[model samples]
Target: MSRIGKRPVELPSGVSASMSGQTIEVKGPKGTQTFTATDDVTIAIDDSSVTVSPRGKSKRARQQWGMTRTIVANLVHGVQNTFKKELEIQGVGYRAQVQGNVLKLNLGLSHDVEFPIPEGITITAAKPTELTVEGHDLQQVGQVASNIRDWRRPEPYKGKGIRYKGEYIFQKEGKKK
Candidate 1:
């Protein structure tokens, strides 16, 4: 039995959810999101709560049961609030700036890197070295942050590059003279 799957997802005030076949759509003040569960799980909505259960006593059904329940819960929360990820640029010349729909990054590379912001995602650079990625979809927000970090991951020697805020880099000693 899956402990997480057994718990029903409760809808907060001003949020509404509807089901069409295997798809569940949730609408809230922030935005509207939909999810379609596989046949291995059954989805039901009742009294401002959503529940998911396995279709049969099979391994795949049991595996999807918990996953489907969590997906529904994420959809509900996503529509009600936005997700955010913060990034920090380290090193002497490393920095970032947002201009219109483009995020300009300077990571000591040969030239500045320009990343085009996608729809539904907002990238803000309050300071030259600080960046915040916000969006209604949790996955998109996280993915954008990761992609930006991949451009110049933090190195252990000088810890120079773009990295998630509060991330730790194991320092390595330099060679002796």
Candidate 2:
């Protein structure tokens, strides 16, 4: 038995959750989000709360139980409160701009890089060096942010490149003269 799977998810006020077959929908003040769960998993919603359970006791079922519950819970939380990830651009002339459904980045390369923002995700430019990513899907948002950061990963030599805000890059000292 999975402890996490047995725990009930508390639904916030003004948030409506519905389970239909293998899918779950959460409607909240911010917006509505849906999640596709595995067939083996079952979701139940009571007054002001939701619970998840799996039919079988197999290894796969155990994994699905926890994973599906987490996904559904994230959807509910996302609709209630937006999730955000911040990124910082380091190096000279490195910056980012939002251009109507696209993110234009200038990371010291001669040519600018254009990143297309996927649906249900929003990107905002905080400062000239800071970029913010907001979305409901935790996996997708993290993947997109990682892809963008991979373009110009911070180097250990000078820690120059794009990195997540508040992330530390350990610098290696130069060789002794």
Candidate 3:
């Protein structure tokens, strides 16, 4: 009944998927990633595609069907290409730069925030205000970007802070005298 689960994940050229019981391992040019689904869903690998199906008609099984399928799709895509998240710094004297294994951020606070870059991920500052986070794992890339943005969320008053690229911050009217 889940439309998303019905669609098989087609492996692209140079990408392959292998299954062992409930665990699935995907290998691609970028890297190899593995995921283990719960007992509610069944995973199978074919010559050029991977499929997920529910074990029964129960609500949990049906819910896991679609969710498992999407997770498998992400695993496949992640092994082939790296995920990236871009961040933009706003406000006067606000900027970011990457030095060695640390990300230095100046958010106009009393002191600069030094964020340690974790392994398996790369953060690049193309410009003082522009930051790009890249990694083969989609989740890690997004989490790191979120952590960076958390340092200084955009304020509604002046929209001054760190924010994801293309994110819109609704500006509020200034205080009336």
Top lDDT: which candidate number? 3
Question: Which segments of candidate 3 are over 4 A away from where they belong?
Answer: none
Give the C-alpha miss distance for residue 121 in model 1, angstroms. 0.7
Residues 83-121, candidate 2, lDDT per residue (tens digit)?
Answer: 888999999888899999999999888899999999988
- Candidate 2 global lDDT: 0.88
For 94-163, candidate 1 gives per-residue lDDT tens digits of 8899999999998888999999999999999999999999998887899999999999999999999988
Q: What are the runs in model 1 whose C-alpha is more than 4 Å off?
A: none
Query: Over 4 Å off in model 2, which ranges?
Result: 175-177
TM-score of each: 0.95, 0.90, 0.96
> Model 1 — which ten-residue stretch has the worst lDDT?
74-83
Worst 10 residues of 3 by lDDT: 74-83
- Find the 10 residues in a row with the least total lDDT in model 2: 75-84
Model 2 RMSD, rounded to 1 decimal: 1.7
lDDT of 1: 0.93
